[model samples]
Target: MATQVTFSEVKNNGLGYWGVLGFFGLLVLGGVFAFLHMHEGHYTTGMNNQVVWGIPHVFAIFLIVAASGAANIATIGTVFGQDVYKPQGRLSLALAGSLLFGGLVVLLLDLGSLGHVIEMAKGALNFKSIFAWNMILYSGFLLIITLYNWTMMDRRKIAKKLYKPLGIVNMAWRFMLTMGTGSIFGFLVARQYYDAAILAPLFIVSSYVFGTAIYSLVLMASFKLTGRDLGDIVLNRLRNSMAVYLVLVLFFEMTRHLTNLYATEHHAVEAYILTGDSIFTSLFWYGQIILGSLVPMFLVWCRFFKNNRLAHVTAAVLAVIGGMIQIYVILIGGQSFPLILFPNAEVSSAFFDGVNNAYTATMSEYLLGIGGVGLAVALVIVGMKGLRLLPTSLADDVIDPLNLEKK
Candidate 1:
């Protein structure tokens, strides 16, 4: 059966008008920033030999992880057959796909040579290298999402029958691609993050949490900006899932640290992250643990979290902010903490040094990083407005328009 509509187009038209304007305004600002930097080269940013990966890496990783995560929201309805999630599926796909556009923008800027990236894409790829595999997988993922979206738009009359197989195919591909992303960070045998076999799973799990959190915030913003209600069924469904997701993330987070605590080689790094007399300690304790983890959890824990829309929205916004901080800690902190000891790999210089000499991001690094974020945000806004994600639905309680006209 076809689900025709509820949300009034007149109201949506108004929102769409202003939303599009705001969206493009941001895109223009980001484009200006990007254009100026493109000519300057990556050297315009903070990245250097000491701290090679900076903010761009942080946001790009977050975007990709968020992109993979978006599937969880869509799949629960399509693949797993949970109807409550149905309302949000299309929006989820749009958000995930859109976020990817933002990620690519930052990554392109981060690469010292856009010219080389083009050659690499056209040239041969070694499947053994995670970078090569990621290039292929990301392209494939983008293609699948584009196709999935096109088919959905055309098949609105009977959305399920036409899209079922596509949904399954998309899921399988995303799982592999997400694994590819994790492998990029996970296989770093030279670093503290690599030794634990659990990093891959961690990325996969956290991707969903981050995806939903980001989507939730955008959903609220879109709804408020447009004056629409996403329907109680959709919101309620998402609320419980959000809570469970947070719980799962916290659990894995605890487990990851516990594992490190047990491993002798990784122990020093974990100590530096957890309680070391270093900057990482502030990031972990203040940013990740407190602002990112605890405060949000406490908000979600309140009985009013589900009942009050603002509380729910707040939880999501905080979670997204915290997740970003966590990403920095994982990527920057892990790299900066130094492996301290090399068991399997031989090293010529292992003499008088501590974590003090470990690498850190520089000023150009911060500028480049901020630029990536601007690009991602601009992408999300443009994609949402250009694409028809924000459907004109008043609420789940409203009678179907098709049924109403029949009467």
Candidate 2:
């Protein structure tokens, strides 16, 4: 039988829908806290002169990275002609746009000079600034994704003809976006934690793991909530893919750190990551490595989780948490370690130039960061209700195999 891939809106309007919406609604209030901080000054938050980026950056950067990764579903379908992933193509584009917007919201809100954002935008662009190039990349992403969506959703032969080429364009665009975002840190030579060229590809790999984990969770949850059958066939494919991404993340992280450790100057930063204070050590070893990497890999490959829905959901949640922790370790941990201004001798200055800086994130920062995630979730929820994003059914037999040689 030919696959009947009819797109449909979620018809359910039960307590679950409203409850989730309400949860995200509360998260939006974090914007108010952010605004207050912006008005009062950044001093009220955990961010000091030393630790400039803080947790808000950690959240914003992760969502933005995952946003690029989320496009991989559509890339797999249109670019490679994978029929199984085609059903997910529309929602992937929608999530990509929404998640990027949400992360942008948190990032803009956290800026000390929120009003100056417009002034800066109006000014001439500096080609040398990675930040300036990112502004262009992000704006272009929204436009391209919108056009891609129109092609996928509109039932016109001309639009259908446009989908494949546009999909290829989007695939390439997302790669550039990931590369630019990673280069934001990688290009920073003064910072010992971020000078490695490997960071660009590492960001790409991380996006793969984070994006897939989030898409899996959202897919499974949306289907189950609306009483749809997401087949083992599809779930297993995603589960396996996520496991491989997790492995790739581990490999890249090890390679990056090992390469850094070889340089004498990088030792201080490495020590901070490996044997720092209780919080840093716990987040790196326990959160990033243990919860983020090893545990999820175990769950993905475990005999008990094979074909088990509960196991897949649990693993997905763990992966998301792990992704966040990894970002936290990289962003916060990088700044927490004292910059080596005077390599020859012990140094002290008003900026705490040669000593490990103490940073304790305030409730406001936490609200703003967590709210960014909530904002992304809210966007997905609203988008589903407003558009035909989900497939009517994803049963094993209902989807057409791309080729006759079936797995």
Candidate 3:
């Protein structure tokens, strides 16, 4: 018989918990200050007409994409009937919701005015705009996730019956949400880097990679600090899953670049990103490819570190860092490449046409991005405290009883 898993709120009310709260609170304050500073004048920031979406977009997009991916755990457990993953459903949903909130907070604040958001909420939306579609998609995601969470937590027979159905809806909504996010760029036909249709699928896969990494890190940390039994079985499963997603992301990335290389029209932008003597090239090769994908792949799959918890943790951290760099390259690097106003003709203009746009992020941008992350993590911590999201234990025997019986 399988061991019945029980859930409980985190019992850690010590200085450690308070310290974490205090630290993230300060970060949130910093983000608010950054927003206020930028509100004084858009001229104070590093953004320009060419590069409007800066570091904050990178962080916001990552959080948003990861939010969709984070819910996959719950989807697998409930929709697919994965017994090992069922106990993790609540935490997964919580994290998904919290991450979305954090990402949206950054995105809204980055707009430079609360009034703009309010106006959008109160005013008419252009149906033709992808941004308008995204507004609907995001709001729908939150609603569906909330409903799914209720089904998971409720013990009534009706709620149990609704679980799988709600899971399916949530899963589909997440895919649409991620795809909508990708389409934001994919629909930008004017930009050299943003016109690819593959971006939709690429973003979907990326969400898997980044989301799983963040979830693993949070799971490990929460279990360790709260003195819960986090088993090798669960960790190993997550490690293997993340490794698979990493490979998919790499494949998609390669395909995207190779497709761009194959096209005559995209040649200039490809050269700029791949071979140019710029930070994008270094970040692509070193930060995204080497450190993010390859290193984590080796760490997670290597037999030497198969059972090493630290190695797994390190891999998760690297994956998150690599994910951020990947987004930066996509958003900033793509915007930095000069737009080809006239194909096959050299055009010069007073607005610095035909030349790469220069942008350097200010401290305010960095603070806002970091603050978004802090908010996401802090929400997770608080959720664990107030709700019975986490299982009492995730021991190998508890999570995988068949293996224990076999042993």
The per-model lDDT (C-alpha) reads 0.68, 0.85, 0.90
**lDDT score, residue 311, model 3?**
94
Question: What ranking emerges by TM-score with the best candidate at the front?
Answer: 3, 2, 1
Candidate 2 per-residue lDDT, tens place, 221-248, comes to: 8898888877777888888888999999
Q: Among all windows of ten consecutive residues in candidate 1, which has the lowest summed lDDT?
A: 398-407
Where does the lowest 10-residue lDDT sum fall in candidate 2? Answer: 398-407
lDDT of 1 by residue, 1-407 (tens): 11444222223456565666566556546545654655586566555554567777887888888888876777776788765555556677777776776676667766766667766758767778988888878888888877766665664656546577777888888888777777787788877755555677777777877888887777777777777766545665565566677677778778989987887877767887888887778987887767776777777777656456777777777777777888888877876754545565544444323444355454554555455555555555655656666566636544233333221
Candidate 3 per-residue C-alpha lDDT over 58-161 given as tens digits, one digit per residue, 9 for 90 to 100: 99999999999899999988888877788998899999988998999999888856676777777778999888998899899989988898888889999888
**Each model's backbone clash number:** 7, 0, 0
Candidate 2 accuracy as lDDT: 0.85
Q: What TM-score does prediction 2 earn?
A: 0.96
Output the lDDT of residue 246, model 2. 91
